[model samples]
Target: MSTESPSITGPLHDLTVIDLTQMLAGPYCTMTLADLGADVIKVEPPAGDLTRHMGPHREGDSPEALGGYFQSVNRNKRSVVLDLKTAAGRTALLRLAATADVLVENFSVGVMDRLGLSYETLSAVNPALVYGCVRGFGDPRTGGSPYADWPAFDITAQAMGGLVAITGPGPGRPLKTGPGIGDIFPAALCAVGILAAVHEARRSGRGQFVEVAMYDAVLSLCERIVYQHSYTGAVPQPQGNTHPLLCPFGLFPTKDGLLALAAPSDRHWREFCALIGRPELGHDERYATNTGRVAHADAVRDVVTRWLSSRTTADALAVLGGRVPCGPVNDAAAIFADPHVRERGMLSEVEQPGSPAPVVIAGQPIKLSRTPSAVRHRAPLLDEHRDEILSASSAAGDPRHNTSQGQVQ
Candidate 1:
């Protein structure tokens, strides 16, 4: 490990998590838990998590099984190979479940039940266990569609959840978000639910089932569309970056780059006009009121663009920042280099478990005065701590105490 790799430490120092989910949704949720200092055991099928081979890879034939996508989300976890298809493997899982504080899975609707690890079954064995399930749609028992058995990925959920319908510029060409918002955001929401349920279990001495559907999560993300369509009886068409209802609240060009400016309030509009050296715009009959400005938004935008064209992005920001709300649309590199980002500590470096060098990663954004979260450890190797985990249980001699050593049969 590199000398600069951060030391592992956090608030959730000893919580144990049994992660049964694979791919993005489940892994991402457990990743969050692992970040907060849970001992996350990533149980993979014998073939391994599908993401182990996902690209953009470090080197085509390198020793590292991690893809860039996998590494980004799967840090601070231990890998355990479990063939749930086998009776012995199922028994091993049950043993692990008996001790886990939380269990997360994203299998197809009935897969867990067929594998004998359904929440109902596991809860019977471990009542205080938080069981989290992330499915493509709502559960079959909760009025999900007949196609509940069908497989879904990010794009499928985005399309079904009304996110793509109003995302692009033209009515005919809606766009999906670049990242897997359908999968990632729902995973985050599911994790939040799992944590909340875990907290309740800690207080009430009972664990509950926590479920999140990607379709439902994406729907929540695009909720404003429902109201807009309802009030006007007009379905929202794709309008690119601009909001249909708000004037001058989207991307605009500066001399060197793009920036987003918001003048949502009338006072801000007046302030924006003065800041852009166009105070007369605030007095012009066609542009004086916010309604007038909205009506002549094109003309107002043109005026603002003209003013911005003469100055560099920094110069334009300097003039408009305090007077009106504004921000330069920074790309990834710019964001990493910005002073505010440094000041806010939004980035950190950690060494991969077996790697010789450090990797820079986006850091925790949320801050708390007390009991703050942290990146406890770099992601774990496959079954790295299995020995440590099972040693205590093995020594205790369970009801099926036929195993010869600390290793689980």
Candidate 2:
């Protein structure tokens, strides 16, 4: 790598993450750790991560060098490209894995074993190395899945994990969430698994393999569906903007747009009644408590919906400001102009590899007092750190440089 690469300053600065992942889930997980100051060494194939070519690029920018999608999930990382089909590449990777604190991959089951880079093999090379994997079902080590060998992606997980089943306008027409929560949620869980395993490794002087199945992770996210099914013994149909058990807990149309309100508890319901100029409703026997309101949901909806129709989003927020939990159902333009997003530094400008103009992207969400993390640098160029990573060549064998490249099977 060059001296221009970002410097380590976060809590994870001492750790090295050997990243063998692509697309969304695995890359996003490693990116989160990289944001926390881990030295993430992205090992790509001879071509590169597929995402490097998948994007809306600047008119003159090279597809091999920049992609909007790749740039979003790959900041603050160093890249190395290697041909794992070659003996030299496998040897180089094993050497790098020997020194790494963690090794993360999202290859299909048995891919690691076929390539001789499984946790069993790597742990023998370095017993303290944390091995993490994100798969459609799960790694065979944890429990062999019936679909262990099936190639899966975000939509497959969302469907099988029960997220798609409950999400949509109604039953028999389930819709995937607008965002790729199927992949993103699994990636987030895998990151959490990596950190938990890392903590245990630090204390026990050993490490183990951890796997996050996309199906399982998304299933966990849709917890209410499972619980409601178990308790009621009936399939829950989509209720649209209204929540099943909580009244005054969904999207309500305003004069101009939409806003969300969640005043299901008795106290909030009382305060909500007062805020909407209906204080008498707080003492009404039919809507006195959450359970009562839920039973009389039609009445509750009529009251709130009518009140919302008479006011605009801003007026509603002004009236309900501190007394109720509510917010505008913001569109992109509104979100961009939002004061809260600005105050929280939610948007960050990052300089990419080939473009003269910097691009704006979402900022790192995690905050640390002593070791803050951020979008410290641009997405890497393919094999940009090859010389620094591979030994027997110039710039290699430096103790400060702790990364290598290899194409995962």
The parts of candidate 2 lying over 4 Å away from their true place are: 1-8, 60-65, 391-409
- Cand. 2 TM to true fold: 0.92
Alpha-carbon error at 313 in model 1, in Å?
Answer: 1.6
Every model: Cα RMSD to truth: 4.2, 4.4
Q: Please provide, for model 2 over 31-67, each residue's C-alpha lDDT reduced to its tens digit, 9 standing for 90 to 100.
A: 9999889989999999899998787777775444477
Q: How much lDDT does candidate 1 score?
A: 0.76
lDDT of each: 0.76, 0.83
Instruction: Give each model a TM-score.
Output: 0.89, 0.92
For candidate 2, the lDDT comes to 0.83
Clashes of 2: 0
- Expressed as tens digits, the lDDT of each residue in 262-380 for candidate 1 is 78677888888877667877778887776777788888788878888878889988888777888988888988888887776666665654456556556565565555555544555
